[model samples]
Each structure stands twice: as structure tokens, then as C-alpha cells.
Target: MMASRILMQRVCCVLVRDLRGSSSYSSSLTASATVQPFLSRTVLRSSCRSVSFNVQDHDDFTERVINSQLPVLIDFHAQWCGPCKILGPRLEKAIAKQKGRIAMAKVDIDEHTDLAIEYGVSAVPTVIAMRGGDVIDQFVGIKDEDQLDSFVEQLIGQ
Candidate 1:
């Protein structure tokens, strides 16, 4: 679950100009590159339940997530659910905010009920984290981008 330090620097100019009354996008502010952080395996092992964010299909889940090099985050959701709707935009914003470092995927429980059932997703908007495809972290509710970032950083401490 090791990751580089993440910052709130991935916001777009339109977002900044809209939120901060400033159109001037700074290189230090809008940067979205993923830097590989140095982490001792022991340190990473100490923080096992770190959070991750990414998106991939159920079939591709194993190959891209479980087996891929980057950690994975899965958002289990259903379109009819309210919290899922709210979390959806937040995660999209996160995707924009942490462009290259994190990956995010949304699972429609209704469409992929089997995956949901296998993962024991009893609720909508449940987020799960995996390192090398093994279930390593999980949360049962909606998390804003900052909270999500902190959760993941705790594992890899990016």
C-alpha cells in the first residue's frame, strides 16, 4: 500500500477559478503526477489497512487490480441508491484530483450482483481497497476526497 505524498494540487483551473476566485493555475497547485515514495516493507506492513481508489470492470478486476502493480480501490454501488449518487461525484472529483496516482472503479450492485454478493456488499457506497489483488482495506460509507486520501496514505503513507 505504499504511495507517494498526495496533495490537493490536482484541481483544474476551472475548479479553482470557480471555487477560489482565481484563474491563475500554478504549477505547484495543479500538478497531478504520481511519484513513487520510498517505503520500507516493514513500514508498509505495519499499516495494512490503507485505502486505495481506482476503477475497473468486474472481469478485469483481478487482472488489473489483484495482479497489477498499483493498488486498487473499488466502490460498490447501485444507481438507485442515494449515498452512492452523492459519493459518485466525490470520487470523480478525486479521480481528477489524484489523476495518475490513484485508480477508481464503480460497481453497480444491480448489474453485478454476483460480485456484490461475493464481496458481501450489503450496502451501497461501500469502498474496498486491495494491494496486489488481496482485500486489504474496506470502508462502509461515503468518504470525501480528503478523507479518502488520508485513508490511502495511512497504508502507504503517500
Candidate 2:
């Protein structure tokens, strides 16, 4: 019984260590864990705010992107897409460098299927640039940070 208790303690320690190291653990475990309230408040505060945000719905898209005074860059992506994840941060970084001249809208294909279909997005990580609610430029695939910077510059007519 003593040896079993020691093994259980070791297992608990390993589980705690793994949870602390993982990025998704805060979201997945906080709701059900006893330390939920504290974790939710602290963990949810940290998010990407440099140059873009997750577009919530169709109405939000209309207000935030189409009606925006600034040129908007829309990134159509899916959570399960590996290339989308790779390209997203790079695009954000490029947009951040542009200051307030441009804005970025992120659309998850799984959540916004209609938007994806309307835009004729056949694959993940399709980026479209819009000005005056019209598509000015677009590209599909992973672009390096430098290429993304050039793309943003072109969109803003710099």
C-alpha cells in the first residue's frame, strides 16, 4: 500500500508538469479543474493582439472588415491545417509592421463555412486583400515573412 501511494504521487507530479508545459492545457483543463476561476481569468487574458483577431461571424466581418476605413487582409484558415498555423503568425508579424495602415481578419473555415465558400476558398491559408469592400489582391499558400510584408505594402498602395 505504501509503494502504491508513492507511485500515485509520482504520476500526479508528472501530470502537473505536463500540464504546465503545454500551450492548450490552460483552455482544456481550466473549465473542469478545481482552480478554474483563477486560471480562466489569468489564462484567457493572454492572446494575439498585435495585428489581427478571430472574426466572430458574418455581421462582425461586415463591420470590421468590409466597412473598415483601412485596407483589410483576410486570412481564411482551419485549425487542423498545418500550413495555416505556420502562415498565420508570419502574416500577423507583417501586418504589425504596417502600423495602422492595414487591418487583418482571421476566418476559421470550420466556423465560417459560408464565408469561405463565398470567397471561393478551396484550401486552407488563403489570404485576400480588400479595399473599399472590393478584393484587390489574393494568394493561397504559405508565404514567408518578407513576402507577406511586400504583400501588405502592395495592398496599402505603398
Candidate 3:
């Protein structure tokens, strides 16, 4: 029953995305009803993951990434980019393997254009590793799990 409810909610989310421009109050209400559980589950997972998060704004980025005690990995990506979608989960898995040795900040380039420009991110799926508020290393493109692990290991070892 819960599985079906979740599936139903997923379908609603897709519908909402497609109908975002439409001014339908009923659609909005249906989405609100269906999305609560999905949002709750997402929040629970994010909290449990602990080391991964989405960047909110410039101030948030400065506070979380620049001022972080641990090394931070910044993932600059976009929703419309296919490679960004593929790299995101793989990067999360790689970050998880670190056991909190490092942290990840997911920055949507479209939302945070300033940050992307400041970081010189001309492409999607750019991963930058920073320590002591300084960029230590960066790469632009998709990397295999092994490569990601190696990158994280290097960052942590620094």
C-alpha cells in the first residue's frame, strides 16, 4: 500500500513539473497532498546522509563550503544537463564511501550563476575540491567510481 502511495506521489511530481506554468489550483492541491510524503522521505535521507547537501545561496555557500572544518567538494551542475544527472548519484555514492571524511555541496549552476562564474565553471558536472577556503583540485566531466574514490581519497589525505 505504501509502495503504491509512493509511486502515485512520484507520478504527481512528474505531472506537477509538466504543468508548472498552468494556473490550476486543483493540480497544485493534488501535488501538495501527494508530495508531502516524498518530501519527508527526501529530508530524512538527506539528514541521514549528513555529508551531502544542496547549496542555497551565496551566503550559504560561504558559510558551508568556505568555512567548513572538513574539506568540501563542490559539484557545479544543471538540471537540463544529462551528464549532470548521471554524475550526481555517482558522486553522492563516492562521497558516502568517505564516511564523513569530507562533505559535498551541490550547486545548481542555473540557480547560482554567480557562484558558477566565480568558480570559473564553464561546463556542467564540474567537481571542485576545496580545503582551507582554497581550491585544491578540480575536474570537468564524468569520472568512474574508482576515479571518484581516488579523488576523494586525495582530498581527504591532503
Candidate 4:
């Protein structure tokens, strides 16, 4: 019964995406060039009015990410991993760019193995975007700012 229900849920998600169509999703994601990424972290951290990005404990991923009132983007990462190191700060930068629009958090797989296993996060930089306890989207591997912008924009449909 549980397996069937889970399968149904997956089907529904796919159906929704197909029905909505990918082009619409893409267009809304990059509607304008308003989301330009900062060229350097130092300048970004220095110049613009700083937007708040909080680093939370691993145990708090569910409380902060899945159940969030605002759309939450979570970077499931580990400390020893090289790609994770590169992606972690990049994820932070992305969050800061659209600070008010999105809530961002991360889970350290080494510290919190359960979240990593539960989410099936086998890779270093698996970013899952969630809203109201449902996963809305995900991005794997290295993503440049424009890609990040579009990925995030897909989650933030008007």
C-alpha cells in the first residue's frame, strides 16, 4: 500500500510538470535579466546591502527546509568533499542574490547522515528546492549563476 501511494505521488508530480510544460517553466525562470550574479564574493559581500543567510544545524533541515512557509533551497553537502566546498559558498551566493524571495539552508551528510540517505543524495551538490513540505525542483552538479538563477526562477513562479 505504501509503495503504491508513493508511486502515485511520483506520477502526480510528473503529470503536473508535463501538463504545465517545460517552456513555460523556463520562461518564468528567466523572464528578465534582473538576476545578475555578482562577479566576486568580496564585492558582493561588501557592496550591496547584505541580505541575511543563516547557517543552520543539520538536524534542523526538515524544520527549516521542508516545512518552510517560504520556498526553501537546501544544499545537501559534506565537508570532506571537494565539490561540496565549491558548491556550498556558491549556493550561499545564490541564496543571497534572491534573499527575500527564498529561504536557504544546508545539510552536512557527514554530520547528518539520515537526511542525506533519506533524500537519496548520493552526489555532493544536490540542491533540492522545497515549499510546503513538497519538493518543487532539484539541481545536480556545478551550476553557474545564470543556471542557478533559472533553476531558482522555476521554483518562484508568479
- Each prediction's total of clashing residue pairs, residues at least 3 apart in sequence or on different chains, is 10, 0, 0, 0
Q: Which ranges of candidate 4 are over 4 A from the true structure?
A: 1-59
Provide the global lDDT of candidate 1 against the true structure: 0.61
Listed in order, each prediction's TM-score against the native is 0.58, 0.68, 0.71, 0.61
lDDT of 1 by residue, 1-158 (tens): 21222122222223444534555434424453421121222232222222333333566566556676666677898878898888878766664555445566567788778888989999888987776767878898888789876766653432
In model 2, how large is the Cα lDDT of residue 113?
98
User: What are the per-residue Cα lDDT tens digits for candidate 3 across 44-74?
Assistant: 2344336887888899799889999999999
Error of 3 at 73 (Å): 0.6
Every model: Cα RMSD to truth = 14.1, 13.5, 12.0, 16.5
Point to the candidate with the largest lDDT.
3
Tell me which residue pairs clash in candidate 1: 4-158, 5-158, 53-103, 54-103, 54-104, 54-105, 55-104, 55-105, 66-133, 153-157
On residues 1-158, what C-alpha lDDT tens digit does candidate 2 reach at each position?
63464345445555555777988776867567665654445333333223476788899799888998889999999999999999998988898888777899999999999999999999988999998889999999998888998899998883
lDDT, candidates in the order shown? 0.61, 0.81, 0.85, 0.66
Q: What is the lDDT of candidate 4?
A: 0.66
Higher-ranked by lDDT: 2 or 4? 2
CA displacement after TM-score superposition, residue 60 of candidate 2 (Å): 0.3
Error of 2 at 128 (Å): 0.3
Q: Predict model 2's lDDT versus the native.
A: 0.81
